[model samples]
Target: MNLLDYVLPCLWAFLACVGFGLVFNIQGVGVLICGLGAGLGWLVYLVCVNFLTGDIFSAFVAAMAIGVYSEIMARIRRCPVTGYLQVALLPLVPGAGIYYTMRYCVEGETQLFLSTLLHTFGFAAALSIGAMLTSSVLRALLPKLRLGRE
Candidate 1:
């Protein structure tokens, strides 16, 4: 991919993070925090896709990492995880995949439509599962960290 591809994705992720922060009523610096989280997550996704030769799996892992990191940061800062996780997860939403699937369906291409729909749903499911699993692990580990007192 070219610079435009990288920059556009990061820009979209940042915008999504800003919207999420606004909707959630996050406090000062939360918007920046969320945007940075999203940018970092997208960077990881881009690096994995470009260098690791992995496909959606790399994206899934990147999303999970973002969720975990966001949770840790939220705990440290005593803020809501929603702001960070929602922004970080913007890159993994499969927006284009779902849009193409819906477009194919509208064109009456049944097989192609179904295939794309399945791919989109599978990608989305993987993202949700990965995020949930990471959150669970973080929850389990947080109690042992003794960071809550800070």
Candidate 2:
């Protein structure tokens, strides 16, 4: 509800992305870029969730932010977008949902497991759709944008 609520999560997301960057051998400024992208996504997610109805929608919006951010950063640095996008999105992945769903399944809680698994799938779908939509739109538009600038 307050600043700390948003800041803490964004900070954690940034750190997590930085760790993923390291694991993926992303070095130098790339790591920082990935961390910033994660923080940016989490910040968007927090703001949207506060104002929007569903967390799923929030995740979608956040993924769009990360997608746009990664695309721009890649262009600026003249590098592949894959590493930045993947590392940045690490924080937003539904790891906890998968874990809990599996735990519930193992415990024979069919109802909870089913619900959680469905919700997790929905969230994942939203994330992928958001990122893909952004990337596709940008790919279509960037050429026009460059021509205009020239």
Candidate 3:
């Protein structure tokens, strides 16, 4: 909604991408491109989900867009989509929910903890399913885009 919210998410996305790139040893301009791509992907996802339609359909569309972008980048860079997708998707993870759930559990709030944990798990499952579906669709559509074994 506000500029701070947008800026923070993009900043996190950039940092996640940079961390992933470092772990995978992706160097030079490719790392910069991946970081930028991750930030843009998160921005696009947030825009679509919040502005267009805050519904399951919008979420799936955003996830698919992320997957496609990551896959395309992986193909170009000759690396696995895991590197790009994981970093690009960090913003979508239910981190706050998970943290709250764990915090409640630690504070002896069993009922609230269970409820929050379930919600977090559900959110995580949705994200996983979306990513898996997107990956499958991409693989089916672009059979020639091999990764990592070039």
Candidate 4:
């Protein structure tokens, strides 16, 4: 396991998320924070994938990390979680999976289409489920995490 395999990809993920944030007009410190969060989340995903060797598990962990970090950043910065979460999750979104699934379908490869479609949907469901779990836990704890405390 070479270091570049992980570090380089994580750096790319961070930059990609930052670019997406800028394109979407996320202002102030959020742009930087969102980018950092994406890198950290990607690191978690890569490490998980390296050890566990499963896409679904890695994506779930990465999505959960993004959700939790976004929630905390939102509380601290008084910004909406969606602003960071959406962009920070850019690394984990299964865009290529969906693209390939559709391509396979269009190419009349039924087996490949079904397999790719299921994998794509599985990844999406994993991310969604992780985010939902994080939101539920965070919502229950948010009141206790009041800002401006001494």
The number of the candidate with the highest lDDT is 2
Q: Write the residue-wise lDDT of candidate 3 on 1-150 in tens digits.
A: 688887798888888888777877877776776687678767777777778865444445656667778777777777777766776666677788989998999999999999888877776776677778978877876765544331
For each candidate in turn, the TM-score is: 0.85, 0.95, 0.75, 0.92
Off by over 4 Å in 4: 145-150
Looking at candidate 1, the ten consecutive residues that score lowest on lDDT are 141-150
lDDT of 1 by residue, 115-145 (tens): 8888888888877887788888878877788
> Candidate 1: misplaced stretches above 4 Å?
1-8
| TM-score for candidate 3 | 0.75
- The RMSD (Cα, Å) of candidate 3 is 3.5
The C-alpha stretches of model 3 lying farther than 4 A from their native spots are 2-4, 52-60, 144-150
Superposition error at 98 for model 1 (Å): 2.0
**Each prediction's Cα lDDT score?**
0.80, 0.91, 0.74, 0.87
Question: For model 4, how does the per-residue alpha-carbon lDDT over 105-128 read when each residue is reduced to its tens digit?
Answer: 999999999999999999999988
In angstroms, how far off is 92's CA in candidate 4?
Answer: 0.7
Candidate 2, overall lDDT? Answer: 0.91
- Please write out the lDDT profile of model 2 over residues 1-150, one tens digit for every residue: 788998998998898889889999998999999999999999999899889889999999999999999988888888888898898888889999999999999999999999999999999999999998998888889878882210
| Backbone clashes, candidate 1 | 0
Report the Cα lDDT for candidate 1: 0.80
| Candidate 1 lDDT score at position 46 | 86
